[model samples]
Target: METESFEDKGGWVIDQQSFVVMNSSYIMAHGMGRPVKDAATTVKFPKTGKYHLWVRTKDWAPFPKGPGKFQVLVDGKSVGQTFGESGSDTWKWYDGGLVDIRNANIKLALKDLTGFNGRCDALLFTDDLKFTPPNELEALTAFRRKLLNLTDKPQEAGRYDLVVVGGGIAGTCAAISAARMGLTVALIQDRPVLGGNNSSEIRVHLMGDVDKNHYPKLGRIVREMDNGDPGNGNPDAKEYGDARKISIVKAEKNISLFLNTHVFKVEKENDIITAVVGRDIATNQERRFSGSFFSDCTGDGTVGFLAGAEFRMGRESKAETGESLAADQSDDFTLGTSNLWASVDRDTVSSFPETPWAMQFSDEYHIDEPKSDWQWETGFGNFNTITQAEQIRDHNLRAIYGNWSYLKKNKAAKYGKKELAWVAYIGGKRESRRIIGDYVLNQMDIQEGKFYPDGSVTATWTIDLHFPDAKNSKYFEGQEFFAGTKHIKVAPYTIPYRCLYSKNIQNLFMAGRNISTTHVAFGSTRVMRTCGMMGEVVGFASYIAAKYKTSPRGVYKDHLAELTGILKGETLAPQP
Candidate 1:
């Protein structure tokens, strides 16, 4: 049992003579501050049996202050995990023991998880003195072994009738609805906050029947988000009403909130999801949750996809679905992203811009050009949205600054040298991957005023599609900006429950812009208010499945009357 180390000019080393190396094994550098991968140096196991893995840290310098994290992987899957505790010396070593080392290639990954920032170390592999690598036969037996640890222990397995995978407006409502009806629920969220897009992170002002003159049920949740005060022209203040309301909802007792956590994998037993793997991003800890029923309200359909739920993405061709509004469809080409900006009244600000702004203005910044305005930031409606967001956000900042700069440099416009104060921290994405559901809502449904007695949510926006050629049209026809084929804003349409469940997988649901809808129908259904309602609907459905000990399909069928009764009672105000 000897160790050998070689140093290259690149400040990293490897032990070529280790006994653990198998055919496909190689040492590679990944993450911050490491040289590229090196060629393979194979090591043949003398005789196969159980083996222990010890990973040594190889850093350029002594250990710095604070804790650090690194990952050791077998084949490509993560196995051994280590953390550097405070007060540890530089280049500290940690041992990953008794791993069922069966993979042909075992590698170590050093990652920096600290906020202050540092680089990962090169890995030094060594052999276990007590045991040896397992043989092919032994490895086959080990492969069948399930890796169960305390981290994966369920606090309550199959105990909760339902599990909701998001804590947004829809998730919260669903959890409350189910819990109030005497069903156990597990509410999961990836953020510290419960609200999804409308959370404080994105900071979009809430809209719906909540603030409207006739609808107060729409306002029920929003009023809870208010500060209970009055303000002028400020949508957040008028909409939220008071800050105290937000505090109360955050303290809701029925919801078992797991924020700042992400669902990574799902385990299936027969056609049912037995457990879900979750990771707490902040702590780097992993856990498992088990429930009889599950609802996916991640907006992006993340959970549903992982659970092997059947879902679709992007628009289907008209020929395929007879969706009328569907055109020649492609994949990965979703809606645009919006970098929302808030304006500060110049009268309250004490500073002025020290530079010029705009593209040669003559006191008139308003134009019919295919562009955006900072006065009222509105986007998320562009072709090539992924790439365009980066361009639009940057251009938006530049335009605002450039405009202010021009005023300061010019004598007219009387803006008195104003400049942009700040940009939004979170960029809102209007559309992305949509989950294919059992039924995809179509454009004709909205046009014909079709109604599903089982409809859980309604959408009122028009079939607004951004032009394909933004830069060359009457506006920027070829540019990546808002371009709608038409605006059919006349009628409101219902989103059915079947369109949310997976077409192939059982017990999985999706909400938000990702739900099953044609691109045209999505343009109308993609709004946050509608998404919130969808969320609530999914949440309630999940609760019913858990309570009745049935599947979501069963709830949509035999229990339709009961489900509708509950939804109607949850109504915020009397319907017009």
Candidate 2:
């Protein structure tokens, strides 16, 4: 038997899911009826013979009709029918008939039948047709490991002084800061590109000021990596500056950047993370990275989740956090995720087909033209943006297409010449699990400007939280698909070094939205530029931890002076 996981698909996304523990990561095509190119991988047969192809997928909805469906193709020939058309709402394997193998080289391809979302966890080919794959997790894991020749315990990819997970602006800055200090570093990102939300995929324009904060050189790397284009919403590659960011990371000598790698496992002992295991999304292979220090730049706090670090989700009550702006009583309600889009103006007339399956807006709220900024957001008021990521994305996509359809079908003359420039398949998230650290910064901290002895990076953005659009909320109630933000301004405040390290997990340092902060303070700290500065501070602190061979918390408790020196751009000498 031979197997291939779509996680290894280079030009694809590994969307977040809670209802499914998929054998492979799945991609959601958000183009509505327009066909989007899917993922592909090559396989070599040990011996040429007939092979029965099977795919691991699900209908997602069993009672009604399934929205997700796709077909299998071998050597450019269809295996006959779409596999995800009919199956249990739960995950299951489906047969794709037999194909005679004439050549050693094989090309496996997926054709998305439904533009909504056609998911496939893995593709399997077996010599014995009766040998059905197992549905259970343990059995399936062993089956795929053996079939794919993957080690249950991954082999070491390399040893690094520091390993930064999540290749957003935060992770990028961390790697550069540490590597420039002569520390060997590894930066692992799930997506093909860096910049996280600001990447071409998500397109959130970077906010906040650099050099104005306590640390002048904190966002130096951010500015260097940026293409300097302030435009948003499907701007040109030059505007997004993807190439420049990649070039900067590639040029670093002390850094080993791993792109398209999903970090899934960790090895820890006595609260110290010894190594991290990342699976190459395109090949289903694994690589283990050993490090003395680790940074969680993942906005969702995934590393903390895998490592058993203490974290907080949703809002903290006004009583618990003592913030007047917080909810009277807290529950799991975050800012939610956004799927944004834009349109292009051409010399000739163009048309967009009406999308019948998209999310709806009231006739008055129906979008006529295109949007090119961050305001085109959705998924709020108790929406599970992390677990129900795909569903939330679909809701946004539906809203996009449904509104466009309303304009095209009812008011054609106005939008007849406009064509879709881009619609992000990737969803931009604002908040998730904030891993517990030595200090939980709250509204009081930012408002009072309480400075710590270990104060490092400064936060500049206002406390901004998104709720459902008031009018849209009136119409859709619980399923509103538009965002309305409430911004509370505050003076620039410093984040303590204690806020960067995991409280329970010793070696793990966290940056970005997942850093230790109350919901209200997270509003200001969650900005990309502020997160980038957190990375810069964490990088230097990581170097101190390695230099003194101490735990992350030890950097503050025992070596604050040296860490403070780095943050203040003082002497290079270490003091412990």
Candidate 3:
């Protein structure tokens, strides 16, 4: 018999005669980060039969074979109760049983003892008890094709009164409040974690209505998380500030969270949306749900676009909205994507890319300035961000690493040598497509402290713009970014309910950064806190609309008192 090590295949290696545990074999017994029972494999038999089976296992520590046993299956069925759990006294032995044969094909399966905590050796199996070429047997092409088809089709379905896309603070609150009102809700998020921009992925700090004099109800949800200030979450922290808060939200009876799922299509009937279709990453299955109303809390207005909702992108011109700061509007211009990185001190660095990294860039693309949150010019949608975060993450990594490499290798005088710190798993997005609502909030609205009686949200943030001219200036070069006119005349402004609805379509409400705000007003309302409140308003309105059997506008007109009462209950603080 020939022996092969498992470490050669980068993971476990399976062959016709035997299997080899490779790379990090210690994880097999003790396991890796998480105990993944689904990823574990088991063998079985077709029927009762006598078959030849060979087994081998390797461990960093001694194999705990005494009380722990490898389960064996015969003829697609389990045989006996269990085998091998004698409590760690034996090594390398074969036992033959006088079992009845019932099928032409037989399978042998090995299961590690529950809670086994050591490396496991690879097990060997053969029909004729002979080792041969790995690919001598025919490939299971038909089985694979069938499995693929099954995985691709959407299978899950349920009824929801309100479905909120995007699980940021806004979305989570939306789902929770709506469900509390006796409405079934589904919250879909593109990331694994919640809190949107405050999520570990985006790493932005969470902020909301704080009295400064005292805490207000607006921050009730976020305050549950003890991650220090709601705003200023340490980007380098391993976990999100509100990650646990998300767990509490998920535990709520009415809210169903679908993480790492993207809403690709919206089913509509006339002006009303019927169902939202989402895709699951693990199983590659699509999920559908029927809802009375839908909230586009995705920040980018993904649902609005799919529902044929009219929207806008980039800075709007004065000709369109009469906003003084509105520049020459163009669809190609956008608020740009964030390239996030976790900074660390040189003394405590790990997983830092070694020198001579493969993705180096020239001096032209280098950014040597020592600053936190350096914005790097990104390639335009080169990879599918929804499915592969690592794809976009790698681009940010390359941009960051390449710039550092360039500084050290070429421009040491202006840009001194720097140590490797940390990197972000994914980049954050500041702006994208904006859904055009009944109102297009302009910069002047913010400057004038404009308030609409129908306003559902109030925001106070500066109209920060990234200038194209500053793209490569000495003051700002190589994804060079600048914050336009801080401490400007902009003040607290109200966001109208009309601005949350599609001008062309009815019964759909948008929230978060993607709502019907001019580029300037979006700068303020886009903040996570305001967005969260926006979500709450939309969510409550959705429930009320369902209750009254009326349009969103109808709810605003007929049930303003009740709608305001619901919003007030959900922690929308009165503007000072």
Candidate 4:
């Protein structure tokens, strides 16, 4: 293959979708209104010749005319072809006709026509259209390696004692804790930064109590990492503190941090996961990370999914989990994702576009203008947070825009002078795909205050379950974008270590909301800081696993005493 492909760099904001062209994909000029700045990437052509430029893009919504549309620029000149508006559900390379490039240096830019998410996976220039690479994952992976001249083995990025798959509060603490224990660690995050939901992109302030009773060291790192307020962001004029989390991760010298890399596939040996395959979001370069143990901090239990681990999604029946909070009968409806937005009181009156595509809300569900925060959430109606994440986020965006538009068009005093200061396309998800472990924590464990020998990570938040807003669900029917929560108070209780690792997959451990908790119990344990504590416990357990050459279950079965000491701060290595 004489064609060389280039991945879109930082100019485009990422839009997360599971089972996409790559595990990671980008959206140009997302969440903002029509503007002029171009999302550009510089590429050096290997040979000077006339070649057909084909862009791999998708029409996210499978309508006649797609929601997103963009133009490709060659050497600052428009290619005259509007991409994304024409492709189907499957991402295929669209021919931008023929283009002549005499010089090696060529600048490719994405000029957006619609503010809707215009996605671009890769751009490949080839002389022959019939000889291009296949779009299937396996074939595509091999072709990418060959085109980039990458090794067949995926090129070992690093071998560590521990590899944490998610970079949320939990994954960060997991990596930090393991690094402090004199273990080499790798922290891989799909997004550009750490702190996952708490990161400014999502802007969910760290929740759950820090420096709690069961274990002080449990949330010690979280206390340090927790910056800004509880809602979306610094509600005041001040900016959100994302740099603090990055600073903490960078300060840990014993860890190799891979940001903007998504781990989509796993290499397993029987029940043990030997390695994980990750692709860089920016460069599209594939790397294999080898480790003694791996943590599925990737909130949807992504690592566990690829490794074929036994996992449960959505709620359990009242009879199954034996919790009153459980549904009458179990189905696939889990806690929905929160897509939050904030508006500032402008000095002058501002206007917003009418959101025709958004779901309609009744008077009861109608949001008051200039007053949106964590309360403005969506995605409980028939939407799967994993497969349908893009739709879920877009649905939220439409609701937010429509609400603002109604208020502005109607000339309401509440939002007459208000302007949308910030709106996030990145959805802050709560629950999905809980990897099955030895212990499936139920509400009875927390409410009954049942103590286990391997208890770790205290639960603080109530059994908060989110449902579709009654009025909104009635109006929108199957596509409700408004949600409401049901909370059940409970005394703080500890989560057992057995709930942290996969029951079938031996080397795989889990943290965050995906830990082995019954749906009802997860309602309380799903907060950011509480998830961090789970990560801390798993991190200590990983060290013990590496130290004793034990499996995750082995750490619990044989070394629970040592693991208890670590959680209690006795075995914690002094923080750097």
**RMSD for each model, in Å, please?**
13.6, 3.3, 13.1, 3.2
TM-score for each predicted model, relative to the true structure: 0.60, 0.91, 0.66, 0.90
State how far residue 559 of model 4 sits from its true place (Å).
Answer: 2.1
List model 2 lDDT by residue over 257-344, tens digit each.
Answer: 8987888888899778899998876666789999888999988888888899999998889889879999999988888887777776
Q: What digit string (tens of lDDT, one per residue) describes model 3 on residues 467-505?
A: 433434453344333222343546666677777767766
Q: Which stretches of candidate 2 lie over 4 Å from their true place?
A: 1-20, 27-32, 37-52, 59-69, 87-90, 97-107, 113-117, 573-576
lDDT of 4 by residue, 402-477 (tens): 6777767665577778777667767888878999999999988988776788888877788888887787767777
lDDT of each candidate versus the true structure: 0.50, 0.77, 0.55, 0.77
Question: In each prediction, how many residue pairs overlap at the backbone (N, C-alpha, C within less than 3 A)?
Answer: 47, 7, 23, 0
Q: Against the correct fold, how does model 4 do in TM-score?
A: 0.90
lDDT minimum window of 10 residues, candidate 3: 16-25
Worst 10 residues of 4 by lDDT: 1-10
Candidate 1, residues 300-371, lDDT tens digits: the string is 566766766665555568777677667676444455544443334455423333322222234454222211
3 against 4, candidate with superior TM-score = 4
